[model samples]
Target: MVPAPGPRTGARPRRRAGGRGRGRLADGHAAVLQERPCWGSLEDDALFALFRKTEPKVQEIAPGHDPLGDLGPRGQCRIQGLDDDRVQWQVEFAVHQLDGLRGQDDGRWPNEFLSPAMVPLGGGLNGMVSENRAWVALPPSCLGRPGEFDGPTVVDASVGNKDVELGGERGERDRTALARAVVRVANGTLRQLGCKDSLADPGKLPPVSRTTPTQMDALCGIKGLKAPDAERESLRRTRVTSGQGGPVRTCDLTHSGRPWSTSVRFMTVEDPQLAKIFSMAAMTGGPRIKGTKGYGTLTPSRAVYERTCRTGRAVFLVEQRQSDRGYTLPRELLPAYAESEAGRLGCGPVEMKMPAGS
Candidate 1:
């Protein structure tokens, strides 16, 4: 009874010019094309084809909502309109990385998608924060049994003083390894999602995008540093220290075969999660913090001073590299992700706490 579906065109079906269904002309008589029933035996086919075409367009335009009625009309958009090829490629790459498809032979489409999306996705803050926390909490199962860090080792120093050593060959190696691991996980995850052009040789990928100094200041939650006022003056005095009794010191240390003058310090915190987050943030953002020949030599000057002054315990022999640019996890978000084993572990409103006495 019903006619066969309309001829299958290679191109998907699209919406009618005016709106749903064909339009009639202004004349008293229906348009010539009106005889061609908009709802015909092939109507279902046409509608399906139209859906195929329009859905993608909708997704491209708005990525926060469903294109089809199946997902319901949330009034939000669900498409991403990626115009720039570079950005498109980067998004693909980052997507591939997140999909866990690194080192796979299935091309690199996932990686390409993810690479560009990083910028628009809050400068990879979401991913970076998530991954760093994961590393601190879970580490890698392949790392083998945990060894007891009694003392005289970098890990030991890190655990004991809650400080990190970011100098020498070992430090560079550890950082490179961690970075590579992150990249691998990101790429590998994306590969599983059918991205073909994501991975194109590590050397070819763009250099790790650097966050602007302004962005860093924003993340630090410091307001009006550039403004002139008594608060600003007080901040200036608090941040700077002079010859004999300055709060910060620039000391030379070798990192990744290069010498760097890094500022080091110690921060006392009660929460272990906060401590882990601070360590991971510093290692990933500030500088490499492992594989150093003299890692054991690092120490926290303030902690030692405090212990000596308060408890009269002469524990000042340990010297470690601590940085001024460390963070403490916000107390508020702790409850939200406390139950999550591997995702979204509570971190919010991170505070830049001063080391002992700023």
Candidate 2:
């Protein structure tokens, strides 16, 4: 059989040796088997599918090896959170010994007397809080662990000199004086942990207020106060119940010469709680009663709601009886009503009339 012949002159071949067969057709090339577009032309979803085909299901990098390093001399490392979302991690460093001085008392000689001797160089100190606690940042490398020094080191380090200058009156460093330095260290450490400056001064920072009237105009134009739905429900529930009672009246008028006086004779259904709720309402809404600042301790047997009508001269009482022994008004009702003028303006169920003469 005759082998298939190559394409005619000026016609490109169908397959290439190395390249993937996904390329775009050149303009006006209507030749056999139209060429597919290059992968770059594919949409994002197609690219993801291509990726999944070429990658392994579970390739491991540095598998079976420990990821963390040894903790330094202090056996401590800074702990930081992974993100603003509150994940925590611990980091560790290598441990090594300090290089100089054999004995603890080696540094005892006065600066003016003995020549300096070599001091042991040691690994830096590591400071840490509890395992899960958050850390602000790491201390400087020099301060982390002191290095060994040779013979009467001239003690001319500017770092040490600065520390001494800023030291407190007690001849030792005062923490308050080091506030700026501490902040610098903390900022550096936080940067290493991959946080933006915004996270550093979060809630404590003051809000940026509108400076121009135009900037605030949008907010100011929003109309109407938001009322809680619960408050509306409570107001609706405070309407006086039918067949329960009539409006209360009093005989002792301030027009006459008597201290404000009104009496409520509670029915068997009325209890201490109901009496208290109404008594509180009267005190808050009505004129101040005699001998009390609007507030009155209820003698449940005597009255439910009592208030001074004309200054301290006359008292009017709204008496009520609970529908059942267990049905006294809730204690919270008074405060609930007082919270809104709409609430306090309306009265609750009442169940009695003031007896004639009393």
Candidate 3:
């Protein structure tokens, strides 16, 4: 594919116009498709064929621009029933530059979507990180529900730090097929942008169930964490989940239910770029975790710790939850959590101690 003119310079005009097709569904939903060639010949017969292969017709919408200047250019479409044309799902496609231009440096894709915070789609092939980009397919309904294996609900493919994400709420029956189509589109988008094809082929994805609640004692075992008060004792619990056997991990503490409340959230990030972003946030101010080879800062709302592990650089975070609290933030909790997580990664010991009562 030839390189197109940059957004700074005038972008090339629309090369072709797609048919404004409409669809109607039995659910009494109707939709209109507005298609404008956002990327010249990149929209080929194969792409059109993929759209037609689905039962519901895809109504293409005009390309969209990001006012925030983070996502450079975008296009969107929605699926609707052929007869009634009621909208059932929406899909988005976008591309950004890699050199941090147009706010590409933001870590939304790398930090949240591609991190362990989100569960893998299936077979672990749908989620991966390479030197150039991080690609993952996630369940759009809820990351907390690991058992939901309809298909790849969300596909995020970022190359050289820039990203192209296809997200939508899809029906259970058609999800797997639609997800493969999205993968093909995403791969095509990457090629059009002159990036390598980093996304793998979406083969038969199996029903995946990875994330699970960790034992409550996971946090209570921390040296400095105080026992929950009698009134809130039963309410205190810990839930843990991680990426599909990847380096990303999360630990959340919450009140069981007596007025559902959140205490603190801990995360370990192995993505190099994301680690850098958190490292920058933690170094701006706040006290460091004593005896740790890494750096950390504690704020009223959160704490961030960065250190090198056996694999590479990693960042750990401890954040206060917005929900009603049932426990206090012990000073030693940060280091204790960090040490425990580091050990899980086979990192050397981190002897941490808070200075005498502040």
Candidate 4:
């Protein structure tokens, strides 16, 4: 049977002399319990117990795979369920501390997880954030499929200033199932921690529609940015998602079923220190985009720019590789893309200037 983490609201599981438990040992020799205290006032131990009741079949699936371990901020713990010695499903959980409200914006969680490849999980991403904390659920990278993204697998819920990220992986089921499961755990954790902002009912969450890149404005969530007919020549499918109708947007494009080749992401960095870093990079790291409020730097791999929007400082990134045969390169479309998005975001006009010939 899968070992329980501990009794709800009670003592944490203890580690034996040479076994897995709350503290770590020195190479199986020393018994000095080196345990990192769980930061923040939230009761994470109680929150984990909810996992036992939240998903009962886990023990039945992989009785040998214990899901108990303490790795918050210092490490992570994973639970796996297998069928005939093969991993059928798995869940990984970890917590990270936030620096004095750093990355405390509404888009913090989404922006951290949003990527060019996070588009195929069907329903996109579901999440909620408040003044003190945040939480999000989305697809996790498949274990068997290696390098492919599919199952909506992870939930990142913050308690106080620390982030509690939980990821789920499934072999045969669809993304929605995992999404629901993770969301349940996330919501349960929030309630256990007495967090005020709980996510909406997971059952009501809708699946994302796989559509062609026909509507530019809708695809990227930026108004007036029309899709270029030529750009669609290589497009096979695209997933566009907005988390809880927030300003953060993600658009990933791919030709094959998995491993999206091209991606467009926009996020507003609310933390002043974070924004200042981007601003400094815009001024010193590379040549300034002529018509925008930020700077532009292009390598063979990715093209990115940052601008000052009415909301604060915003970042726009277009990552693509020529081998992917996905979308046009940095020089071909990034300038126009940045301009359109900047305008929609209520930022000043920007013009990108490529360095001297070639």
Instruction: Write down the lDDT of every candidate, Cα atoms only.
Output: 0.20, 0.21, 0.43, 0.39
Full candidate order by lDDT, most accurate first? 3, 4, 2, 1
Candidate 2 C-alpha lDDT tens digits along 70-146: 21111111112122223322122111222123321112211101111101111221211111111122332323332
Off by over 4 Å in 2: 1-292, 299-320, 324-327, 330-358
Best TM-score among the predictions, by candidate number: 3
Pairwise TM-score winner, candidates 1 and 2: 1
Clashes per candidate, residues 3 or more apart or on different chains: 67, 22, 14, 13
Winner on lDDT (3 vs 4): 3
Estimate TM-scores for all models: 0.19, 0.14, 0.58, 0.50
Angstrom error of the Cα, residue 64, model 4: value is: 27
Error of 4 at 193 (Å): 9.6
Local accuracy of candidate 4 as per-residue lDDT tens digits, 1-358: 0112333335343321222442222432222223311121113233233222121112111011123522111122343433333554344433222222222221333343443222222233344322112235322121122111111222343222221223233211223333444455544444433445454444333333343543544445456554556555444456565334333455655554233344433333322223432343344344445443456565544555766677656666565543435444555556666777667666757766754424
lDDT digits (tens) for residues 225-284 of candidate 1: 121221121122111111221111111111221112212111221122212212222222
Lowest lDDT block of 10, candidate 1: 150-159
Error of 4 at 53 (Å): 12
Candidate 3 achieves a global lDDT of: 0.43
Supply the global lDDT for candidate 2: 0.21
Top candidate when judged by lDDT against the true structure: 3
Candidate 2 vs. true structure, TM-score: 0.14
